[model samples]
Target: MSLGKSRLWGVVARGMAMGAADVVPGVSGGTIAFITGIYQELLDSISRVGPHALTVLRRHGPLVAWQYINGSFLLSLFTGILISVVSLARLIGYLLDTYPVVVWGFFFGLVLASVIPILRRVPRWNTGAVIYLILGVLVAIGVSELRPAQVPATPLTLFLSGGLAICAMILPGISGSFILLMIGIYPHVLTAVHELQLVKLLSFAAGAVTGLMLFSRLLSWLMHHYVARTLAFLGGILLGSLKIIWPWKLPSDEVAAMGDKMAPLMSNTSPWTFAEVTGESSYLLAAGAAALMAVLIVLAVDFWGHRRGAHH
Candidate 1:
């Protein structure tokens, strides 16, 4: 519960990584949390932030309640998330726009490499665990295949979108931004962030808080009782999500007609096919390098985390 200065900064850095991942539609901040070894702690902290914390506040004091809920960790993590989200939103958008293959390649490699560490954490793989893992993969692929729906961007819709998206955002394979995009609110949310639309952002934040409070408890319980199965399922999700972030994509005719270059319809292809179909260079070498770099980064982080855990 105590966050020393060095540890606080470490948590902040992890949060920033999560935030950056969440900005991209196919990447989950939760994936970053898992790879960085904070997934369980993050869930437990969020799950503790309600009635008990209130009771503790009234009976003990603000400080006791804060400690009970791991307030410092949450604060440090969220501060990093906010900072990264605000600063990287535009930049990430630009990169995805201008260099789609390279950007997607990097995240693709990140999620792919992340699956190894996650699956390793599963102590044993039973029949039920395998089934759950397969189910997770199927569900993620199904979600990825969904086309964006048309929805009005009213406050109510934004609130609902936030609630749904936040749940996905915390899951290792599911992406909150992808959820928003599916609901047809991604552009609205991104525009609000970019333009600093306070009212809209606050509405979204309120929904996210409510959803996080409710979902975290259930996820935490599942994780506790079904550790191996839960991890397997999440690992499956990461595997399933690889299809969504594939570097070579052929834009859907509808998306091209809409003039929305960035919001592709998740049509995948090989680099050769992409180049042949679009007559644009697939940038295969560059994309491959990016993916390779991401894989190395994830492996390094995983190794470092294990070493640190051993020390602890």
Candidate 2:
């Protein structure tokens, strides 16, 4: 295939993967983008909608700003993500509700397998990289351990939460919706979006646009100047995030009643060891492992192909 065709296919594959990830709560599309080696490009593309874009908008109008933005790239990538999210949301939600262990286990494997591709990209390992990795891991572990907070479920709050959550959504190891959950906004924002609350939805969209544009620039700058270290840190974040994504559990006793609607609240208590070992559900773990292995194999093939192309 021509280089352009090859790149096009690669982007399409990435979009699909990203969409799949976005459908999962703890997993992140950013992780898929990072693992697939298009993270920097995505960040750069987002960052391009910057001050200059605002200036163009002010001078010429929204059309000018749209022209300045990489609309094609954004449209293609986001369309894929949107399709995946919308199509899979109900299915993923059902799986998480009905077969929580299996779904989470699968994600655990996927994230674990992702580490290999991420770490392999670092041409050199050093003290700084090691420290960054450790730091990232620690942060993830800490974040995972944090108890979810309680906050108001209001339109403005949902808007802000949407913005912040989407920003984290784009980071390789961070889960945007998870962040919303932490802030007690996940349910509210999701409800607003689902209910077709136009005001809330538009507000949330504005916030997401602002957050994506701003955060992308910062990310792009870091990737440009501190490429290796940033990736190392990101790898650590991914490692840390696994705790949250890990499938398997003991039931939580804590239940919060939200206006007669009872919701199970996860506690700090650890899962049962027995459940992890001997259970009919043990098959799920094996399946998860297989899925992870498949991801690794696909990544390896892509890497090999890219290397061969470079050599030729």
Candidate 2 least-lDDT 10 residues: 266-275
* Candidate 2 residue-wise lDDT, 178-286, digit = tens: 7877777666666776788788778778888888888888889988888778878888999999878766554476654333366775533233563554353444556
- Model 1 / residue 241 / CA error / Å: 0.5
- Clashing pairs for predicted structure model 1, backbone only: none
What C-alpha lDDT do the candidate models reach, one value each?
Answer: 0.90, 0.74
The TM-score of predicted model 2 comes to: 0.83
Q: Which predicted model would earn the best TM-score?
A: 1
Top candidate (lDDT): 1
Q: Give TM per candidate.
A: 0.93, 0.83
The all-Cα superposition gives candidate 1 an RMSD in Å to the true structure of 2.3
Candidate 1, 175-264: lDDT as tens digits: 987788777888888788888999899989999989999999989998999999999999999999998888998867655112244544
